[model samples]
Target: MIGGILVLAAMLLTGTLTFWQQVERALADNAYTFANSYLDMAVTLAGVLMVLRGLVYVLRMQRELRNFKDDTWSCLELLIHGLRDDVRSIRRHLPIMLGGLLLLGLLSRLQLILGGVGFNDGWAELILVGIGVLMVYAFFRYRLQVHVRPRLEALEAVRRELAGDSLKPDDL
Candidate 1:
């Protein structure tokens, strides 16, 4: 869902910028040209940063999952299995999401680079950027909810199991 939102934002931003550039070219306005370029640069930079951040998060999650299996707790053992499965799911989907975002960012950057497009500030742009921000937030939530929490639960379960306590599914 977050991936879908990011892709949508990328598409909207790219289209808006391209159309705005065409309109600017038609008018041949010299005003605010530098500001427009900077804005475009900022958006591109933000998107790239998001991709890098996501990659880092995925790497960190993988490392944690690796450590999880080595823990001695019986509950952790169960958790390790579930976490492994979760990590696998994340690994499968994350690269595709990153690739799509990267492609969108690249295409947007290309438009700015080759077309010398002018970007004016508008409410629509703000909304789209906000959506992009929300998508990032959603991704973070997914990582925590799907990956981190499960691993932590597994570890806790292992601890309980080692302590000779039975675990409920809710305990997990």
Candidate 2:
């Protein structure tokens, strides 16, 4: 999912950059009217694409959750097999995520120090970082509710049943 978003963002940035270049060309040719129209169109198109991408993302997430709930036995099996590795992987990625955020901040500060003017006030990157954090939190919550807790409860029940069986006096 993150990969899909990154790819979409890259494509949008490419399209926007291409439109910006066309605007520059129009201005260089003294076609101010054409430049203004193209700039407006580019901004509008980018905004629409962003909104559409967000809607698609939400729809995809909902579909995934539904599918997950439908095949919870598979989810439980996966958790049983890989829960420890999943946890260790998450632990490893935490520092990477934090480092990426720190690097983003440092780069933004460095650009400012170098008298570089950005297109926006860095709010876009901050929002992306915030969303990433929220997604990670949501994933953990979902796993706990849907996978880990259920599996733990199942194991507990099995243990209790075994204990009760051992207490029976028939085959001793």
Candidate 3:
């Protein structure tokens, strides 16, 4: 709110950009840089998270082996417990992740609405801009999920296997 106002004030004071010029530049920036950077960051971060998830599983498995080399049940129990913790962590953090998506949607909509300033003077136009933003967000959400799905499936598989056959994996 205040931050947005301050940014606009800075732009005006600098005399380097009129509102329309800034809008055009912002459109180009968003089209070329912001979305691409956001997507790249998302993919990279998801990969990092998956790697960390795998590490947690491996570390716990190793610790279980070290502690209960002779106790098969304890090893399985530890493995299952550790995997459950990871699943729980994901469940707990899911809302925050979705909130980030929602916030991004709102910010993008605000940008679009601001850009459309001279073109349409009605609040109805603002609502239309918001709808467009949601459409864009939906596309982003689908694409991101497509990329992240396999990693999630792999994690879920390990969790399910541990839960279903905890006693057997301990032998190997």
Candidate 4:
């Protein structure tokens, strides 16, 4: 999925560059306006794709959660596993998201500097700052999880003891 997204983004970028070149060659009266419109469409499409991807991920997670057995200990274990997976997923994607945002910001700034209608500096800065905030938020959540997991495991241990079951190590 990530590969497909990257490929599509690259294709859109290549097409945009090609179109800009053609517009430059033709020197049409509304070339910049048309180019800007096309760029906007491409960016909008990318945004929509990202939102859809996130929605799908959330739905899938919900479905998986629904499948677990309806026992407290099992549910707790599932939650611990889910948190670990969530952290891993975030860690894997954070860099890619950051890089993509930075690239987008750079492209927008370049377009502005080159006298083309493009995303304003404020918008780009806002996006970068938003990503930074999200990064920080994810980091804190991960720290909380790190601190919380052991306590959860201990609770699981106590539960097992009360149930006269031997404590077992988690496979996570």
Candidate 5:
């Protein structure tokens, strides 16, 4: 494997061989094939950030209305308005996300080749990237445990109160 890499590296640097240039071009050709998908991922992420923003906005508006002694209707309207806007935002990004994901599936085969897995061509790269994504998710969820678990646990008390289940903050 090391020997094969050394040979390929030499060929890429030399440029005396047309084959190496062709391979490089092939690898780089669909650079934007996944651009939209990546953008879609960003847009989806912004939706989560917006939830926090909306919560702040709602709380501020609710507090301001309390001064006027007629806050219920205003708060409800603000919540509904924010929700509608968020739903529209998410809906708008759906097609972009789907298109981008489809492109990722087509273009992500580069992963296996770059990762030095010995897969030069074909659908194996796509499958490998899929497996890679799953492995990454599992690592984050189980091994690293770095994502959503903490937030969920922290909110457990609120969730139980909302459901009228209990007032215990034990999980937190």
Candidate 6:
């Protein structure tokens, strides 16, 4: 917060000097030029810092993606082994939902072709359908990750260790 205040102060000071050049000799003629140059340098430096911050953000996101990949794979293995029932439940529901959506798509197309629906040919209808499908998929993913999958994986891990066929350190 202090750094932000300093940056704001520097910017405001520069702006005031630039706009009110006649109020002070330090902001007149070559003195003004020098001060203005310094302000430009400060602004450029700030921009460079922002770019560096963006690079750091990207680096952190990349690291997170790698970690998520490892975790997701481990969880998937556990789900397959220990939570067959839950996985089967998801698999059963997902296909039916997908099929229903697909049927709606066909119906929409047919309506457009036959002039049976007002929105049959419009891009808006198609976009709405696309968004709806995406929302459904997102919900499914959330449920799999947070609701049914974690417990299943934990149980599977415990079962494996009990059977003396435990996972390697790298697997965990």
> What is the Cα root-mean-square deviation between model 1 and the actual structure?
12.7
lDDT of each: 0.56, 0.54, 0.51, 0.57, 0.47, 0.53
What is candidate 2's TM-score against the reference?
Answer: 0.35
Q: Which stretches of candidate 1 lie over 4 Å from their true place?
A: 1-35, 54-121, 163-172
Candidate that would win on TM-score = 4
- The residue-by-residue lDDT of candidate 2 on 1-172, one tens digit each, is 6676766677767767766776677567754444124324434444545555464555555554555565555544443444444444345654465455545555544554465444564545555655655676678667766875676667555555645765668755
Q: What is the overall TM-score of model 1 with all chains considered together?
A: 0.37
Off by over 4 Å in 2: 1-81, 91-106, 114-120, 156-172
Q: List the residue pairs that clash in candidate 1.
A: 75-157, 75-158, 76-158, 79-154
Residues 1-172 of candidate 1 have per-residue lDDT tens digits of: 4575576567656655765674565358655443344346446545555555555455555565676556466435555655555565456555566455445544554555565554534334544655675676578568868767766676766677677678666876
Candidate 3 residues 1-172, lDDT tens each? 4564455455434433333344455467756433223333333344444455555555666676686665655555565566456555554554465456445544544554566634333435435545654675566456445644554565556656756766575677
> Looking at model 5, which ten-residue stretch has the lowest summed lDDT?
33-42
TM-score of each: 0.37, 0.35, 0.38, 0.41, 0.28, 0.37
lDDT of 5 at 128: 58
TM-score result, candidate 3? 0.38
Runs of candidate 4 exceeding 4 Å displacement: 1-46, 70-78, 111-172
Model 2: pairs clashing at backbone N, Cα or C within 3 Å: none
Between 1 and 3, whose TM-score is larger? 3
- Looking at model 1, residue 17 earns an lDDT score of 70
Please count the clashing residue pairs in each candidate, in the order shown: 4, 0, 0, 0, 1, 0
Candidate 5 stretches greater than 4 Å from native: 1-70, 110-172
List candidate 6 segments past 4 Å from native.
Answer: 1-82, 115-123, 164-172
How many clashes would you count in candidate 5?
1
Error of 3 at 34 (Å): 3.4
